[model samples]
Target: MESEINKSPKASAFTLIVAFVCVALVGLALVPLLPVKLNPSRTLPGFTVRFSMPGTSARVVEMTATSKLEAMLARVKGIRGIYSTSGNGWGSISVNLDKHVDAAVARFEASTIIRQTWPELPDGVSYPYIQMQSPGQGSQSPFMTFTINAPATPVLIQRYAEEHIKTRLAQLSGIYKINLSGATPMEWRLEYDSEQLRTLGISTDDIREAVRLHYQKEFMGTYDVEQGASDRQWIRLALVPESESRDFDAGRIQVKMKDGRMIGLNELVKVSRVEEQPQSYYRINGLNSVYLSVVAEETANQLALSKEVKAYMDGIRSQLPAGYEIHTGYDATEFIREELNRIYLRTGVTVAILLLFVLLITFSPEYLFLIVVSLSVNIAIAVIFYYAFGLEMQLYSLAGITVSLNLVIDNTIVMSDHYLRCGNRKVFMSVLAATLTTIGALVIIFFLDEKIRLNLQDFAAVVIINLGVSLLVALFFVPSLIDKIGLERRKRISPSKPKLKL
Candidate 1:
């Protein structure tokens, strides 16, 4: 009766083992398919709308332009607070959105409202502007920028960037948007002749009016119908310089002065297509250069994106000037790759040592196989879960997986150690109790842990999964395997005749 008391079921361990292998394989396959990124920038997306009325008073711009745009954007979605800087003839409308709102959506909504309001503004006043809330855009987006400065001509830099670099950099997958900031290459520079106008008895205001007439012939005001809403409309009147090539000289324009004076406006001022550059300068390696910045997209895979970016750069080496070179201010690609590899290597070593220790203690190869199967399956489940949730394989997340190494071995130890000690029915019941107790504790830990944002929580999650699966394997399969296995080392009983002879 005692011999048969150690009742173990049929060979179901093999079936569970097969299921574990299938699950593990599926999970491992899901890793590369996940959207991975190396976003180390702590900065969030935020921008403001900027409009300027150059040479005009700040007060005038504020009262007429700034106030109206502010009121309009205030009606658009996603507005936290509005802060403005009314300097000289420029005003900026800073806006912050709720965390849930996407920045791109915010920009679109703001732009649409501004377009509808453009008709109401004075001719010289610009349309209400909206730009991203970038705190240190130079540092954040580009990681590095080189300003191509030509002593007086900056437009060449702008032209070169537009014609050459901007599009090339945009091809890099990880980069979000590349923007050129410094003085761009210019085509037209029309200067007002101060002295020639004085001789003509025409004030500067007269010349300004002449140029204004060239752009706008008949003012088109908004039309309002009876018992209906007003319609914003613009009726084109004059053909200003349609293209940069069309020079605004005295020969082309007919100027009607404020007084009885009549003159060819071109004769009063010099209107020639001179290379015009912005006043701002860009510097790289202590030399002035054209500045271009590269930003990362939402789903940019940092490691792969960088590798592709470098490849693309290599392909365009002939495109860059002899003195020009690429540099990085915020390349987290190499760092992330290194961290991931480190974790992978560590995991490999830890797993090897762990299996070796477990095998040595059990002196059983079969149990070792079970340990490997359970762990592999456990990790596979976690990876699949992550991919299904659309979670990126970030460094912190990988860190969580690596840190789980120690805990992953716990279930295997419990199951294998108990199986070897299960001499009979009492031993089997005790093993079951031990397994249940360990499982209960793991469940408690799983619910209590909450650092899911980083490596800690991820590690815990994997551990909990691995242990739970291991316990299930132990309960449903390992006991049966133990009973059938180790059959050669059975207990030997002496016959009743042997006791009588003694």
Candidate 2:
């Protein structure tokens, strides 16, 4: 390889330049494809289980549901701690796992334990919902919040938002979750007449039991019937009794009295369907409103997702009914956009400063141009690495790239100077040693705890990749370019001393 290169340095230089140019082109193409976010997404070493038991007190929920779940979850391996909270009619348990444990495996085991313990829970308790608790999930604000205001009732506004706004936004890509609130659900309310109940000698507990039993359906055994006399074929039919209907008719229900008399429930209690009082209220400009909170997927590009959501909302704005309006409650993407703009500005300024410094030091356009090309190729290679590693163009990663710019310039200058002053072998060894030392320090990030590693890994990886690429460019491309441009020969040639005329 050495003899071949010495024989045809131009061909070798051309090949190297073309290869790097192609790499730079490919990296530029991937710029738009990179996923951009405000920060790195990290899954913490924890899992949460939430459950609810309507109409049950917190104490009852703790005793019957939360306690059992915590006890069962504790038996799973790699668990560090189990924390629980019991609220009115609801409960939650958070399980923290050891840093070295595989999150997916731990989640599966925890889920299995929860399912096994489910049957032991009270009948009123709902199924336990398991979810991985990512870092900052509890305090992280929604990506976007939209409020709906109108002249209509809160229920009407909520229904419209649910059917139109929420559903439409959810259909867009990158939407992870949507939550709608600020409206009350409708429920059947029953008012009992004390005098009629006393006269019928029926107690409230009896009425409750009767109502509960009325809704219970019973399934009888299947019956087989002969379809045809000649063929003697039989068809089996399932038997089920229709015990209750969704529509509540007062006369259809009956309460048994202490005197052994059955009376229509309408005589003792009046039933009406009405909207329940709102548990939580939302208001905008002194008017009741409904709002939707949208959360994007962790790996999603926030800028793109935000734009898509806003465009969709604008497209539907005209379709809303008269007096109905959609207002932006809060937009997290605005901050992200501003931060990105700042990063871009800082990057441009940094590149400019580095170029000026290179010119001042080298005073030769050839060296300056070589450094520029090296920087470009180094950055392009780093971008390719980012895409390969599934790293996001976020704050931390961008910061990494920005900080690595200085190092890229440094490597190029060092290699070019040494190559001109010394030769290929010594410069190559020097650059290689420097690059390896920097990488060795960065490799320590991978050995840290998983939580810390996840947060810092992207930064370390970007720096390491940039440095490695810079090394390669400094060793191969820079020297080849120097030989092609004859810069080394120019520097080595000394001006001939003029003959003195005595």
Candidate 3:
């Protein structure tokens, strides 16, 4: 191949151009389709179980919710450890799996176990929030935060957020979760005089029963009538009362006394709207506020997602009531973009230094151009490999690209220098030896089972692919250019014969 290329330098140059054009075509096509993310968490095999039972004590939560969940999760396959948290009104369990476990399979198994144990939980506990999560990347952090500052009560803000803001935000694409803080959930409050209740022979339990009887929906089977021989229909029947009131304070409830006298609930208790105890308190710049923390999906572009969210918020701001304003806060994408910018700046500086050093050594424009071409081709090809493998571009992967840049430049400089000294015949052999030695050291990283290696395989993969491309460019493309451009022949100064002594 070398001799043939040496015989027809133009053919070699054409081959190199065609090869790079093919790489460029692939790179351009795949670049837009590649998934972009701020940061990618290295997920391990694990699952989390969350349970909430309002008004329950920690002891009850532990014995009834946590213990039963742990017992069920223990039966899951590849169980390495079980850790749980039992708190007032809530319980959580984390089941860790062996390193060899498949995350998806573990999730399925854990979900099955949760389904089996869900029925065993005591009455009053809400359905358990069961999910699979990686220990390393358990859940993504909030992508953006905004504070709703309004001249309104906490209950009012909570209602508005739930009814208006939350509903709007949930409609946006790529949003995973929207967490509200400093706003209390709506709950019915009943304040009663102890003496009045005692005189009426009524308890809080009686009042609760009355409310449940009025509010609870009941299924009453169906009412069916035959309309025609081929068309008989049944109307579903439900115990829905048209006169039921939504406002708790509007009308009086009736309670039958033990002695057959009836009393109005208004005479016994006062119903009012109030904040729940341990209410969430959110304040920004010393103003009453409700904080919204928006988390984005794992595969989303944090920067682009934030922009879309900002635009939506802006569009809706004019519709807000007087004295209500939305204050944008802590955008996580800024940090991610900042980190990327730093990497880019460092890479630019490294390239500048490499170019300056090469100029000082070779002082030839042709050699400089060849070096740039070789480096660009190899790095571009490396990027194609990154997207081809379904890897999300992240901090570690960017770092790998930075390192790959230096390796490609190194290979280019060495082979270019070798060609300027020796002929093209020796350039390929020398570059092959150097490239093989560098690649051999990285081969072990792909096989290691250590945590760091698992987290860094994308980095190693980038490096290896770039190295391989660098070898191709150094062995073929660079040599072909040097021979075709006739830049490999360094001008030799023939010693002039000393003038005959005359």
Candidate 4:
């Protein structure tokens, strides 16, 4: 009755019960919404910008496409960092946020930035593009491509990989972006009539100059100016502007003579379009083969996605060219999942150590009930954070959760130990007041210290919630149960009083 009377004045008793129930419901309801992605970090939306310029080497790409894209992208808001890479005929740019940003918003922002800045960029650059989705989901590479070269007809091998194998693999789940490298067919060529060229005294170098002059852009140098701390420069180039870059006329090109006479290039050589050299070169199992890589949708589960991809690959082996097969494979999902699992294992070990230490010090299993309740409180609250933040159980958040368990248990130990030390009802009231006071004093430490608050926010929050729960559990629930029911049955050790020949 005394406990009931004390509890009536404090609304915490009822509020705590209501909070626990509501939070429990929230936590349970959110389970279905958690993304099943193999890499939890991959679910956060992002966009990749890609550009390619044929005949332009890597260094040229750095100066032309990468520079222009980077300069223009600098102004976009919410950008955490800009990453750029350039290779022969290709350049890729990635902008990422430290925190999860809305994917649609990031894509739209990135696309608009690329689009508006295109005209100011150097020529020969293909239109900038943003990847609509990432390929190869879960823990496996979505595509594994090995090339088979038969000296007989490499073209047939390439055509088979494309018309049959690629088409088939595209149908698999979480698989997209199937790229085939080093498979272009050999080109048929027509050499210029050197005898006719000699009759006209036209040199081969002149023929090459004529061919290049009609098609390619020639870069001019940059103009530099001094700024307060740096020098700025703008490069200039004359281009066969978009509309004229496709000009492929054979009649207008010339073969120049030593005597200054000229003859049309078409008159000396039969000009026709044939296949160009293969763009990519690859080998597998000591045999000539093309490379194929498959990527997956970012939101897909890595483990499940990899599993499905492997299953499809195994099933489709018979469909591949007899001599051709998947030679190499790699999966990002598997690596990330393994890392998350490690974090989880560490979390379990840390919690176990904390529980054992608390139980040992108390020398009472009943006291452990508080620690159990505290850990549960944290788990329940972690679910709330998961929903509020859309935090996938990423390795980073897992680390936070592990630290939080210790905090929740720590706070409970402080509160319950105080309750245990109280000798009388007045002492109980004093100890309870003291417990709340000590909590208040220590609570500020979680927030007041930046490192502690940031690194341990999860643990701190769990402790906070658990602390509140522990108090209410003690003041109302524990007290009511203890008073109305009775003290826990204690093990009877043989009376110590002069144990006479017992």
Among these predicted structures, which one has the highest lDDT?
2
Per residue, candidate 4 scores C-alpha lDDT tens digits across 316-394 of 6766656666644556556667777887788778877878887787576666665575456546655765657444444
Candidate 2: pairs in clash: none
lDDT per residue (tens digit) for residues 1-502 in model 1: 4345355545465565566567768889877666555532323345688765656788888888888888888876766677777777678888866545678888877877876776686655643445575321222444324344433334555666667767777866557776666653334334554455565677644554565556552221111111213432211112221233444455665566557756776666555454322435566556555555566664556666666766765665566665555444456666677877888899999899988987787677866776675566667766777766555566655665676556556654565455555433434345456656655654554455222223234344444454555555555544444444543332211122335553
Number of clashes found in candidate 4 = 17
What TM-score against the true fold does each predicted structure earn? 0.55, 0.72, 0.69, 0.52
- Evaluated at residue 316, the lDDT of candidate 1 is 58
Please, what is the whole-model Cα lDDT of each candidate in the order they appear?
A: 0.56, 0.74, 0.69, 0.55
Backbone clashes for every candidate come to 17, 0, 0, 17
lDDT of 3 by residue, 1-502 (tens): 6575334345566687678757867876666555556666566567787766767999999998899889888887888789999998888988877778888887777766765675576755644655676644526678799888887876677678778888898998888888887865433445566566667687654654454345542211111111334452211111222111445541556666667787776666555543444524776666678888998876666667888899989977989988888988888778788988999999999998989888887677777787887777776676687777766667877788898788788888887667656555456666667778888887878777645675687777777888888887776677677765545343332234589886
Least accurate stretch of 10 residues (summed lDDT) in model 1? 219-228
Structural RMSD, model 1: 11.3
lDDT by residue (307-414, candidate 2, tens digit) is 999999998898998888898888877887898789889989988887888788667787778778788888987788788988877778888888888888888888
TM-score of 4: 0.52
Error of 1 at 197 (Å): 14
TM-score, prediction 3: 0.69
Point to the candidate with the largest TM-score. Answer: 2
